[model samples]
Target: MKETDIKELNERIQKESAFVDMLNLEMHKVIIGQKHMLESMLIGLLSNGHILLEGVPGLAKTLAIKSLARTIEAKYSRIQFTPDLLPADLLGTMVYSQKKEEFQVKKGPIFANFILADEINRSPAKVQSALLEAMQEKQITIGENTYSLDEPFLVMATQNPLEQEGTYPLPEAQVDRFMLKVIINYPTKDEEKHIIRENITGAFPETKAIIKPTDILKARGIVREVYLDEKIENYITDIVFATRYPAENKLKKFDGMISYGGSPRASINLALAAKAFAFIKRRGYVIPEDIRAVAYDVMRHRIGLTYEAEAENITTEDIISEILNTVEVP
Candidate 1:
């Protein structure tokens, strides 16, 4: 890309940055901290992918998604996953109407634009499977009728990592369907103080509507048009390739640490995520830095570690950092 092209792209990116900043401002009203978490959510929205948020309870995971849905003017639905939650409860069921003397398809909460699957691990695999199909295909089939979901469909599922009691862990296949698995940590001392003060005073910031669902859909279409240079594209491919074959890529530390690396979806998601990151940053063409910025979130949950690595207390973040350091930049 030429300097002139870069300048033009940068200009466009700056304009888009205002829209992204507006979203952040709205979310900041209800959310005290977790800026990175909010950014990952925006990236997921721009990239048109689902997200799995892992955190302890009371981290504002539910509040954040709801606030975001409000800001974007999207329909929001929250499903509290439990042990007895049935598939029909998630995907809707067929009901026989007495007046019509025909079976009617009553849609569940999953038909909304933005759905929050709260404590998703609390549900069994069978229940999870119902959501999996909808998350992947953006549609549900009740009896013989197939219903397409509303446009701009997104599932922001949350899971409690600290507690496992009576909880069914999400299968690896189900986890892979999510584009990013974001981990939300506790707020800082000052942010916590702010939260306490706001709660005590009954004064909370209000999130104003920044963009409508239509605007988001248009922005997503614009993101698809964002350019990716061949060198940067090769760079993303090489990083994902290195994850699978660490030794070949000269990532010796990762050889035993990782039993399985990211799949082809990782590469594709990386490119799409980088474009979204760039789009949010007000750039039209993706750069190596954009890929590096989002590589961890995109690859963290996709990579599976060995038992030894787990016992050694090595985390996916550590492995991702190593891969980032080891991979050559374009």
Candidate 2:
């Protein structure tokens, strides 16, 4: 692209992305900290992918998603997954209506535009698998009828990191369906102090519905048009390829640490996520920084850690960091 075209695109992006500021201001009124978490949620929504949130309890994980749902004109549902949760519970079941003399298909909470799967790990594999299926297909089958979910559908799931006694770990295949796996931490003392005062005063601000559902759909279309260079595409491919063929790519240090690497979906998500990050930054073209900004979330849950790496206290983050640092930027 020419310099003049690039300049024009950037200007257009700035004009279209003005709502981002409004969104940030409204979200901050209710949320004290965790800026990264908020941005990741927007990215996932814009990219049309599900997100997995890992954090300790009482970190405002639930509140953040709730506040976000309130800011947009969309249907929101919060499903509390427990030990007794069933597939029919997550996905709507068919109930026979004697008056109608037929089975009526009732949709579940998955039909909403935004879903907060609170404590998703508390459920069994059957429930988890059902949710993931809806996420991947963007629709669900009720009895003999298949229903398509509404557009702009996003699932933001939260799971406690400290508890494993009653939790069921997500299978690798199921976890791979999520586009990003965000790890959130506690807030700073200053932010915490502000939170305490605000909670006690009963003067918490609320986020108005700033954008319509169509606005978001339009923004996503713009995000898809964002420029991606051929070199940048190759860069994304190499990063995912490194995870699979580390030794061949001169990353022998991680050869034994990684039992499995990212799949092709990782490459696709990385490119889409990088484009969304660029759009958020009001840029028309994706740079290496855009890719780096989202690399952790996109690749974290995709890699499988080896027994040797686990024995040595190595984590998927460590492997991802190394891969990002070693991969040459175009």
Candidate 3:
């Protein structure tokens, strides 16, 4: 883009995205810390992608989503995934009506704009698969009738890490549908102190509807319009390719550490997430820093580590760090 156009876009985005700060402030009123997780959630929302959150209990993972929904005035639903959960339980089943004597379609919690699938890993595979269509297709079929989900649809699923003993791990194919997988950590000591003060004093804040779904759609369009030079595109491609063929990318040390590299979807999500990151910062163009900020969350879950690496105490984050450090920036 020319200097004038870039300047205009910058000003326009800055004006339209004023709500970003408001969203942050409102969430902070309720949530203590986890800035990374909060920003990742915004990225997922702006990019129109589903997010999977892995964190232990008391991390405010549930409260964060609720506060976000409250801020946007979007419909919210929380589906508790359990061992006995069935496909029909989540996607809804046909209900027999006494008066009409015909089966009526009773929609499940998936109809909401913001969905919190608590303990998603606790449910069986069959029950989990029920979300595949809704998450990917953005629509659900009920008794031969299809129902389209509301715009700005975002599914934030959380899994408990400490109690994975009886949990059914999400399959790779199922996991790929998510745009990013965020691993949330606990708050800092000072932040925890603030949380304690807030809880004790009953000083919780509410988020208002700063922007509507149409406004979000407009912002998403703007995010796509954010200029990404060819060099940056190549940079993203190289990073993803390294995940698949580490040796070829001059990272031979990671040969056996990774069983498989990130898929094509990983590349797409990485680029989209970078664009969203840039937009979040009110930038008119994407830079290497934008990609770096979101690379771990976008690729961590997508990167399948080998058993050998796990035995050696290596992790997907390690592989991602090496790849990013080795890959030349644009």
Candidate 1, residue 79: CA error in Å?
0.4
- Candidate 3's TM-score: 0.97
- Model 3 residue pairs with clashes: none
Index of the highest-lDDT prediction? 2
lDDT of each: 0.89, 0.91, 0.89
Candidate 2 shows a clash count of 0
lDDT of 1 by residue, 173-247 (tens): 789899988888999999999999999999877777788888888888878878899999899888888888888
- Cα lDDT of model 3 by residue, 16-117, tens digit: 778889888888877878999999999999999999999888899889898888888888999999999888888888999999999998888888889999
Point out where model 1 deviates above 4 Å. 1-13
TM-score of each: 0.95, 0.96, 0.97
| TM-score-better candidate, 1 vs 2 | 2
Residue 202 error, candidate 2, Å: 1.9
Better of 1 and 3 by lDDT: 3
lDDT: which is higher, 2 or 3? Answer: 2
